[model samples]
Target: MSTLLIKNARNIVTMDGERNVYPGGSLYAEGQRIVAIGYDLPYDKADAVIDAGGKIVYPGMINTHHHLYQNLTRNIPFAQQCGLFDWLLTLYEVWRQLRPEDVYVSAAVGIGELLKSGCTTTSDHFYCFPNGVSGELIDEEIRAAQELGIRFYPTRGSMSLGRSGGGLPPDEVCQDERTILTDTRRVIERYHDADRFSMLRIGVAPCSPFSVTTDLLRESAALARSYGVRMHTHLAETEDEERFCIGRFGLRPLDYMEKHGWIGDDVWFAHGIWFDDGEIARLGHHRCGIAHCPTSNMKLSSGTMPLAKMLKAGVRVGLGVDGSASNDDSNMLLETKIAHLVHRLTDGPTAPGAEDFLKIATVGSARVLGWEDAIGSLEPGKAADLFIIDASKLEFAGALFDDAALPVLTGLSQTVDTTIVGGRIVVMDGALVGVDERKLAESAQAAADRLLGEATFRTKIDYRARRNALSM
Candidate 1:
C-alpha cells in the first residue's frame, strides 16, 4: 500500500464534527484512507510527502451537480441573457451535434478547472445524447475523470420527453424510456462502486420534469434504488419549470417528484431555487438533497435560493457550478465565493457565513451523494481528500486571521497550489499533474468550432455573429 504525508501546514481546517483547526498540522494517509491528522504525526516516512509550509489545508470541496459536457458551449452570446427555458432552447441546437470526442475533451477541461480550483470530488449531470451519435458518451466522461485522477460521480442522465411531447429538447436529442432505463442499468452494473474511498460512482438521473415522463422518473428511481446508487435531476430551478410542472402535472415540482417516489435521501435535485415553505419542510423531513448553483442562478437572473430558510428547515444544501454553459466556468472555489456573497445579500444576517458554505461544499455535498461516510472531511479512516492554498500569497496576505474563511473571502482570483484526491496529488502548483492543459484546450476549441459550425449550417442561424454583435 502506498503512503502519503502532508506536514507543517500553517493551518489544517478539518471540517470534522467539532470543526477542528490545527496550527502547523500534519496528516498521514495509507492508501486511500487517512490514518492520522494533527500536530507532529509520528512515523513520517512515506512514498510521497507534501511540505505545506506557509499554506492552509482544508477538506477538499465537493461539487454536487454539473454538466461537464457543457464546457464546450460556455458564454454563447445569444444564450447569455436568456433564462433557463430560452437558454436550453438556444443551446440544444448546438448540443445536439455533440460527438463522443466532444464529451471527452469537455470533461477534461471542466474537471481540470475544478481540480485547479480546489475541488477534489465532483458529480456531473450529463443528459444530452444526440440521436445519431453512437457509443456510450458517459463512458468518455468516466475516462477523462480517470485520466485526471479526480473523484467522479457521473449520473446517467436521460431526456425522454421531447419537444413533440412538450419537453424543452428536440425529439432527436431525446431517447425512448426503454433505452434510457436499460442504459441506466448497464452503467450502474458496469461502473458503480459503493466501497469506501471509491474513485467513481454512477447515479441515475432523468434530465428534469419537463424533459422526462412520470413513468421514466419512477422507473429510474427504482432502477437506482435496486442498484443501491443515488439519483439526481434538475428541479425547481426556474419559474418556467414551476409553471411547466403545474401545467402538466397539477402539482408543484416537489409534490410531483414525491408522487413519483423521488423523495428520499438518495435523491438530489439541482438548482432548487423555486420551492416554497411547504416544499422546503417536506424536503427537510424526507431528507432530500439540493444542489445550489448560485452563479448559474445569478447569470440566468433566476431568483436567489432561500438558503437561510432551507438551512433553518434542516434541508440538505450543497454547492455546485451547475453547467459551464450557464455559469460559464467550472471553478468550485469561485462557486463557493458566490454562494457566500449571494446569500449574504439576500438572506442578510440569517445567511450562513463563508465558513458555513465551506462546510456545505464539503460535508453537505458528500451527504448529497450519500458518500458522507467516506470522502467528506479529513479524519482518521476517511478518504484523504483535501487541497492546500498558500495563504502567504498577495491576495491572502492580510486574511490569515480567519483561516477558515480565506478561500471564500480573499482567495478569490487564484487557484489552490495543490489538490490531493484519495492520497494522490492530481494538481500541484496550480496545474494538473497528469494532463497537458495546452493540448487539451486546443482540442476543446476544435471540438467547439466543429459543433457550432455544424449547428449554424444546419439551422441557418449565425450563432457566432450573434455573439459578435454583443461586442460591437
Candidate 2:
C-alpha cells in the first residue's frame, strides 16, 4: 500500500461539523482514505510527500449536477443567446448528431476542467440519446471518469416523451419507456457501487418534467430505490418549465414531481431556481435537495434562486455548474463565487458568506449525492480527496487571514496547485497527472468541432476501439 504525506500546509480548512482550520498542518493518507490530519501527526514511511508550506488545503469541492456531454457544444452562437427552452431546442438538433466518441471525449474535457478548478468529485446528468447511437453511452462517460481519476456519479438520464408525445425534445432524441428503463437496469447492474469511498455510483435521472412521461419518472425512481441508489433530474429551472408543467400536468413543477414519488432525501434536482417559500419549505421538510446553478440561471436570464429562504428553511441546498452548453464552462470555483455574489445582490450582502458557500460546494454537495460519510470533509477515515492552492500566489495577496472564505470572496478563477482524489494525485503543480492536456485539448476541440459541424468528422470512432485504446 502506498502512503502520501501532505506536510506543512499553510492552512487546512476542514469543512467538518465545526468548520475547523489547521495552521501549519499535515495530512497523511494510505490507500484511499485519510489516516491522520493535524499539526505534526506521527508519520515516518511514505511513498510521496507534498510540501504545501504556503498552500491552503480544502476538501475537494463536490459538484451536485452537470451535463458533461454538452462540453462538445459549448457556446454555440445560436444557443448562447436564448432562454432555457429556446436554448435546448436549438442545441438538441446538434446534440442529436452525437457519436460514442463524442460522449467519451466530451466527458474527459468536462471532468478535466473540473479537476483543474479543484473539484474532486462531480455528478453528471447526461440525458440526451439520439436514434442509432449506441446504448452504452453512460459506460463511455464512466470510462472517461475512471481514466481521469475523478470521483463520478453518472445518472442513467433518459428522455422518453418527445414533441410528438407532447414533450420539448424532438422525437428522434427520445427513447421509449421500456428502452430507457432496461438500459437503466443494465448500467446499474454493470457499474453502480454502493460501498462507502467507492469512486463510481449510478443515479437514475429523467430529463425533466417537460420531456419525460409521468410513468417513466415513477418507474425510474422505483428502480433507483430498489437498487439502493440516488435519483436526479432537471426541475424548476425556469418559468417556462413551470408553465409547461402547469399546462400539461395541471400542477407546478415540484407538485408534479411529488405526485410521481420523486421527493425525499433520495432525490435531488438541478436548477431549482423558481421554487417559492412554500415549495422550499416542503422540500426542506422532506429533506429533498436542490442543486442551485447560479451561473446558468443568470446566463439564461432565469430568475435567481431563493437561496436565503431555502437555507433558512433548512433545505438541503448544494452547488452545480449545470452544463457546459449553458454555463459555457465547468469551473466550480467560478460557480461558487457567482453563487455568493448573486445571492448578495438579490438577498443581501450578508446572505451566504464565503464559509457557507464553501460548505455548500463541499459537504452540502456530498450530502446531495449521498456521499457525505466518505468524501466531503478533510478528516481521518474520510477519503483523501482535496485540492491545494498556494495562498502566497499573487491573486490571494492580502487575503490569507480567512482561508475558508478566500476562494469565494476574492474569486480564484484559475487552476489550483494540486488536486488529489481517493488518496491519489490526479493533478500536480497546476497540471493534470497521467494526461496530456495539450493532446486532450486538441482531440476534444477536434471532436467538438465535428459534433457542431465546424470540423468535418473524417474519422469515425468505434466505441470498442476507443475502449481498447483506453485499456492500453
Candidate 3:
C-alpha cells in the first residue's frame, strides 16, 4: 500500500469529537485512511512526505452545495443587480444554451477554484438541462471532478415545471417526470457509492420549489430513498420562493416539503433562509440538513438566515459556496470568512465564532452529506482529506494566536499551500497538481462567450443594453 505523511505542522486543528488542536503535530496515512495523528508520529519512511512546518493543518473544508455548471455564467452584467427571481429569469436564457462541453469546462474551473481555496469534497446541484442538448451533462461533470481528483457528490438535478405551469424556467429547459426519474436511477446505479472513503456519490435534486412540480418533488425523493441515496434541492431561498410556494401549494415551503415526505436526515436543502421559528424547530426535530450560502444570499439580497436560531434548535447546518452564477466564484475559505462575518453582524456577540463556522464547513458539512463517519476530521481511521495553510504568510502574521480560527478570520484571498484528498495530493504550492490553469481559464472564457452569443441571437435580447439601461 502507498503511504503518505505530513510532519511538523505548526498546529493541527483536528475537528474531532473533542475538537482537538495538536501543536507541532504530525499525521501519517496508509492509502486513503489516516493511520495516526498526533505529536511526533513514529516511522520515518513513506512514499511521500509533506514538511508542514510553520503551516496550520485542518481537515479540508467540505462544500455542501454548488451549481458547478454556473461557473460559465458568472459575472453576467444584466444579472448582477437583480434579486433571486429576476436573476433567474435573466440567466435561464443563457443557461439553456449550455452544451456538454460547457458543463465539463465549468465544473473543472469551479472545482479547481474550490481546491485552491482548500475544499476537498464538494456537492454540486446541476439541474438545468436544455431540451436538445446531451442528457449526459452529469457524466461530463463527473469526468471533470475525476480529472481534478476531488471527492465529488453530484446530484442529478431536474426541473419539470415550466412557465406554462407558473414556474420560473421556460418549458424548453424542463423535462418530463419519467425522463427525470429514469436518469436519476441510471446515475445512482452507475455512480452512487455508499462505502467509506468513496470518491463519488450521486443524489437526486429536482431543482427548486418554483421550478419543479409537487409530483416531481415527491417522486424524486421516493427514487432517492429507494436507492438508499441522499436527496437535495433548493428551498426557502428567497421571499419570491416563499410566495410561490404559498400561492401554489397553500403551505409554506417547509410544510409543503414535509407533506411530500421530504423532511428527513437524508435530505438537505440549499439556501434555507426563509423559514419561521416553528419551521426551524420542525427541521431540527426531523434532523434535516441545511446548506448555508452566506455570500450568495447577500449577493441576491436574500435575508439573513436565522443561523443562531437554527443551531439553537439543533438543526444540522453546513457551509456551501452555492452556485458561481450567484456567488460569482467557488472559494470555500472565502465562504467561511463571509459566513463568520455575516453572522457576527446579524447575530451580535452571541453569534457562533470563526472556529464554529470552520467546524460547520468540515464536520457539519460531512454530516449533511451523510459522510461524517468517513471524512470530516483528522483522526485515525478517517479519510486522509486535509489542507495546509502557511500560517507564516504575511496576511497571517498576527493571527496565529487562534490556529482553528486562522483561516476563517484572516485567510482572505489566501490559497492553501497544499490540498490532499483520499491520500493523494491534488494541489501543491497553491496550484493544481496536474492541470494547466491558464489553458483552462481560456477555454472557459471561450465557451462562455459562445453560449452568451448564441443565447442573445436566439432571444433577440441585448444583455449589455439592458445592463446599461438599468444602470442609467
Candidate 4:
C-alpha cells in the first residue's frame, strides 16, 4: 500500500514496447508495480516523491551471470595472466577454503558494488563448496541480498566429476552426485519462489561440460524441468574447451550438449565465444540464451563472441560480469560499455549505438534471466524496478548534449545516483541506505584472509601436466 512517485526526471529511457524516451517525465508506483508512466505528473498526494530534476531514469540493469563468492579470491597474482583452463585450475585450490560466512560476506560486497553501478537484479552461479560447508551457503547469500534490497537469483550450482573421474577440479573440491542432487532438491523446496515480483528465484546449474559428468548434466536438466527452474552452465568458452570435448567425447561442445539433452529454452550458457555457425543455429533452434562476457573474454584472450551475428540470427543475447576472479569486478555498467565497444570492433566500426548496449544491459539481460515479464522495462504493469543516474557526477559532466538526449546511455555518462528495487529505494544520492558498507568490507577482508591462509589454498594448481604440445 506504499505509494511513490518520481517527477520531473530530466530524461526517462523507457525500454517498453514502444521504446519511448520522455523528457521531463513522471512515473508512479503503488505496491510493487508501476502504475503510471508519462510526463508532468501530480506528485502532491504521494507518500514519497523523488524529485529527479537533474537525473536520468531507466529500467534497472540485470546481471545474467556472476560468481558473487569469487570476490574474495580476486586478483590472486599467480592466476592473473592464464588462459581459460589454466585460470580455473589456478583458482580452484584457493576456492576450496571458502566457508558459509565467507560466502555471505563476499556476496554482500559484490552485490553492493553492483548496486552502485546500477544493477538492481543479479544472478549468482556459486558452484564451489568444500570442507563440509552446508547448502545454507545459498540461504546466507539470500539474506545478504535482502539486507541490500536487490532482486537476487541464486542458482543451486554443483560439480559432480572430480579429477579422479576425469574432471577439471581436484577430488577435494567436487561433491558426490547423489549429495548434489539431494541438496539441490532441498534448496528448491525451501526457496524457489515462482510469483511475480518475488525477490528471490532458484536456478539449477551443474558447473560446466568439463567439471560435470554427462549423466549429471542430463539428470540436472531433467530435475530442473520437473521443478520448472532454469538451467545454466559454461559452454564453448575457449578453443581449449572445443578441443577437449572433441578429443574426449568425439563431439563439439554444442553437439555434446545436444546429445546430453542440455539445449533448450530454459537454458543459458556463459561465454558463447567459440560457437561455429552450426552451433549458433542449434542455439537458435532450441531458443537457448547466451551471457556474453566481453571483458572476461578479452582479459583471458578468449576470442570475441559474435554478438552482432547472434542478434541477427535471433539468438537471445544478454550481458554478464562473469566471475569476479576472471573479470575482477561486478560493475555492470562497465561491462555493458565494454560490450558496446567490442561489438563495434567485431562489426568493423560504425555499428550499434549506446542505446543498443543499454537495452542489452536492461531488457536483454532480463530476457536471459527470465525476468522480462516482471522487471525489465519502465512500463505500466511491470515491477517498478529502475535506477537513476546523476548527470552532475564528474564522469558524466558535460556529457548530456542538446535538449533531446539520445536514446542511448553512453559509456561516458552512466553514473548511478540512486537505485530502486521493486518500488523500494535501496540507494539514494550515491550512498547505500540500510547496511554500513564499511562494516561489510572489513568482515569480507577478514574472511578472505582466512581462506587465503589455508595450507592447500596457498598452493597453485599447475595444469602443466595436462598441457599437451597442441594446447597452444
- Which of candidates 1 and 4 is the stronger one according to lDDT? 1
Candidate numbers, best lDDT first, in rank order: 3, 1, 2, 4
lDDT of 4 by residue, 95-129 (tens): 88878888889999999988888889999987897
- Per-model TM-score, in order, reads 0.98, 0.95, 0.98, 0.94
Please report, in order, the local distance difference test score of every candidate based on alpha carbons: 0.90, 0.87, 0.91, 0.83
Q: Pick by lDDT: which candidate is best? A: 3
lDDT of 2 by residue, 397-445 (tens): 8877888998877745568889999889999988999899999989988
What tens-digit string does per-residue lDDT give for candidate 3 at 1-472? 8899889889889999999988988999999999999875786789999888899889999999999999999888777888888888888999999999999999999999999999999999989999999988999999999999999999999999999988989998999999999988999999888889899999999998888988998898888888899999988999888888889989889889889988999999998898999999999998999999999999999988899999989899999999999999899999999999998999889999989999999999999999999988999999999999998788897766889988988956669999999999999999999999999999999999998898889888765544643321
| Runs off by more than 4 Å, candidate 4 | 402-415, 455-472
Off by over 4 Å in 1: 467-472
Residue-level lDDT of model 1, residues 69-140, one tens digit each, is: 999999677677677787788889999999999999999999999999999999999889899897499999
Q: Candidate 4: which pairs clash?
A: 355-408
